[model samples]
Target: MTDTPIFQPGDALASARRTLLTEAQAIETLAARLDDAFAEAVRLLLACRGRVVVSGLGKTGHIGRKIAATLASTGTPAFFLHAAEAVHGDLGMLTAQDVLIALSHSGASQELLTVLPAVRRLGAKVIAITGNPQSELAQLADIHLNGAVDQEACPLNLAPTASTTAALALGDALAVACLEARGFGPEDFARSHPGGALGRRLLTHVRDVMRQGGAVPRVPLSATLFQALEEMSAKGMGMTVIVDDANRPAGIFTDGDLRRLIERRGDLRGLLAAEGMSRNPRTIAAEALAVDAAAQMDEQRLSQMLVVGKQGELIGALHMHDLMAAKVV
Candidate 1:
């Protein structure tokens, strides 16, 4: 076994800083080197009717996988195909309408070079990302993106460090440019990521997390304060909706109103729900988003909101707790 040298804390930190600075500079240099070729590549990808197929080997393969994911999530149809695997039979995944993005630092990866003729014969256009502009892969490509970097961050300057960073940054720029050019909005993004937070906020409606029918606390306006309290206690919503004979919400009575009533009247035996209730309670449509409801509640300093229909009749109720339970808040 070889003896290892112990690194001091400062030595480790300094090394990390240098690595970051080197990678950052590599991306900066790549940005400065961008030309009409970058725009042409973007146009090629944007015009593709079929999927984008990214192919690479070694560390470049890992970056290719991430690039494919970013492209897919940002509205571009894309997937990764291992260059070595392509020769083994996976090349069948390629189609005439597809666009192939080939990655190689030296631009001479044997597996990629071997599959190039087959890809061309299949009629798919090629975009090569390489450090060597004069290499065979770059020369054969329909559009070549120069991803050259000054040096690697490796101590020996041999490991794939800064080169990979530059390549990944270039991939991200392509994905984002395609996304913007397509006019992809948040709603479009949310559709692609239904399990994410933004998806829940945009897709989940109030009816999905509201208390309906018997579960909602409600009472007639003619009911005594005692009856409203009974309904509130049974439903556990901290408040009760006071509706008229047609079942339209006339007012709302909460715990705060009860306390205020007791302080003012001193005797609540004959007080009716209508007299104690707060008039013109805030209402939200059952079809609205739960996040929008939460925003309305926050704006009004309310813990609960009445859900009404097109005819302004009470249909359901929503509490802040309901939104929390649904993970929409």
Candidate 2:
């Protein structure tokens, strides 16, 4: 049976700290080593007519996958191709207009080396990221990015720890530079991530969530307070909009208003909706973003908002509960 190492909390903590420090230092060193070659690499990627293909093996391959995803999400067309897969038949995925980013910390991965000549013959440019500047991969590449680290963070100084961290940081720097150069913004990002929260906030419109047609709680301005209360109860929005003959919103009456009116006057006698309602209520365009509507509600401390059309006519109603149900809150 193989003996397991004894568990020592102190030693484990020390090792963890050392690993973090080593990886952090590796990234710092990579940043300091950036030169005109990095700019040229970014230019090459930007000028490419086709997609960016990233390839690597083992631990570096994992890093390459993440880099490709970052590039793709940030408005650069990119994908990852495993080095071993490329040597087999996946090289066909490459086109003359494409740019290849090959990762090999040793700068001598056999799989990458085997695919390099064919990639070159296909008329695609190559960008190599390796720890050794004098390595054959670096020499063969059209542009070389130095990802060299002082040492690995492993206790034995053998495993790829600090080196992988450096490579990832360098890849991230390249992606961010391309993103900024392309003027990629939150809207563009949201388009690519439609299933995420930011996409919901940006893409969902007030009309998409606001209650429309007969669902909206509304009444004529000349209606009695009891009639307005009936409309609010039927719509279940805790509020009712009072509109004029033109269907333009004249005022709003809420449960809070009803409570205050009863507390002040204590009379259930002939009160018009106009006399009981609050005038000049807040209204939003149906085309406005739901997140914007949410923001307005928060700023005004409102539980409900009226939706209006271009001609100041009532079209729908929006409530805080609707925003909550849509997850736009």
Estimate every model's Cα lDDT from 0 to 1. Answer: 0.96, 0.94
RMSD in Å for model 1: 1.3
Worst 10 residues of 2 by lDDT: 268-277
Candidate 2 lDDT for residue 325: 94
Candidate 1: which stretches are off by over 4 Å? none
Query: What C-alpha lDDT, on a 0 to 100 scale, does residue 266 get in candidate 2?
Result: 88
Candidate 2 stretches with Cα past 4 Å from truth are none
lDDT tens per residue, model 1, 96-206: 999999999999999999999999999999999999999999999999999999999998899999999999999999999999999999999999989999999998999
TM-scores for candidates 1 onward, in order: 0.97, 0.97
* Residue range 125-208, candidate 2, lDDT tens digits: 999999999999999999999999999999788999999999999999999999999999999999988888999998899999
